[model samples]
Target: MSFCSWFKEEEYRNHFEPGLYVCVECEYELFSSQAKYEHHTPWPAFTKTVHKDSVSKVPEEGRPGALKVSCGKCGNGLGHEFLKDGPDGKMSRF
Candidate 1:
């Protein structure tokens, strides 16, 4: 099965409050409170990562047009990243 198939649409559209988020297994800090934003999507959204190396992007083989976002350290699947227009009128990763 494809990795992207493991997740439901609702998983990506959920909302989260502003707070620190870490990897469940390694407790590696992934995102900070300031990065959280409401994209009105099923999954929690963030404006950016806590650091440049906090997350890694893997190309989805089954879904050629999609990219999977994973934890940089433990390689846990976080979600997907998309180019969305942010409040600043610039394309932002979410």
Candidate 2:
């Protein structure tokens, strides 16, 4: 199985239900599946965080004018955030 599938399966087996996601190390609740959607990207995508303090967006290194999302609690690099139009035709940062 693909790495994504394996990771998702482990999440499922661990009773990580929809609308909830936590950091592996700190157990800091991060993204909500409510904001999650298929973006056809290699990794999982979410429209927003469950709370504003859940993550911190920092300027990416060696990538001028780019942003990277990191875990607020443990400072883990979650992913990058993109400012673009969402599926709902609204401005979104994901």
Candidate 3:
């Protein structure tokens, strides 16, 4: 998916209020703002989900280790995530 289509370029990006990010299509709780971080990318990046099963990851074809993320509650396409080493010297989902 394109970056513009996957993200909401609104108050959520610059704002840092602690809360949950819900799906636009289904209003399903996806991730918490607490785990949200800046990856120096144009899109909002999150390091964690609200629950272990909040989002489902499907392996992307022709892309090793890159998974497409979607809302587990409603199957709405959210974005893509990867398991990468965080800047804090720990492993995280980004």
Candidate 4:
């Protein structure tokens, strides 16, 4: 199956407990539940990503508040995330 298809499946969507997934663009091994799926938007988003180097921040485009992130290697838009107050009283981006 295609890499995007694998990630889009309902079984894998938002399910990070088992810790399985590889960065499609870089083929990097990512085994952390730190990444999660949020339905706030269309594409998948993680509460915490792998690392700054693993992804690239895309400048706001189109709309006034269009924050986006994309794969460094392929330039495929991963998703957008925003910082908000977490339950722990700490600011988090998800």
Top of the candidates by lDDT: 3
lDDT of 2 at 56: 81
Question: Which scores better on lDDT, 2 or 4?
Answer: 2
Candidate 3 at 43: error in angstroms? 1.2
Give the Cα error of residue 53 in candidate 2, in Å. Answer: 0.5
Q: Model 4: per-residue lDDT, tens digit, 1-94?
A: 0012325454455554756455666675432455554443333445454655555654466644345656655676555434332223333342
TM-score of each candidate structure, all chains considered together: 0.68, 0.67, 0.74, 0.52
True-vs-predicted CA distance for residue 85, candidate 4, Å: 10
State the local distance difference test value for candidate 2: 0.60
lDDT of the candidates, in the order given: 0.63, 0.60, 0.65, 0.47
Q: How accurate is candidate 3 locally (lDDT)?
A: 0.65
How many steric overlaps are in each model, in order?
7, 0, 0, 0
Candidate 3 residue lDDT tens string, 1-94: 1112433454455656888888898888877888777554455667777877778878878877567778888888776655453435344553
Off by over 4 Å in 2: 1-17, 85-91
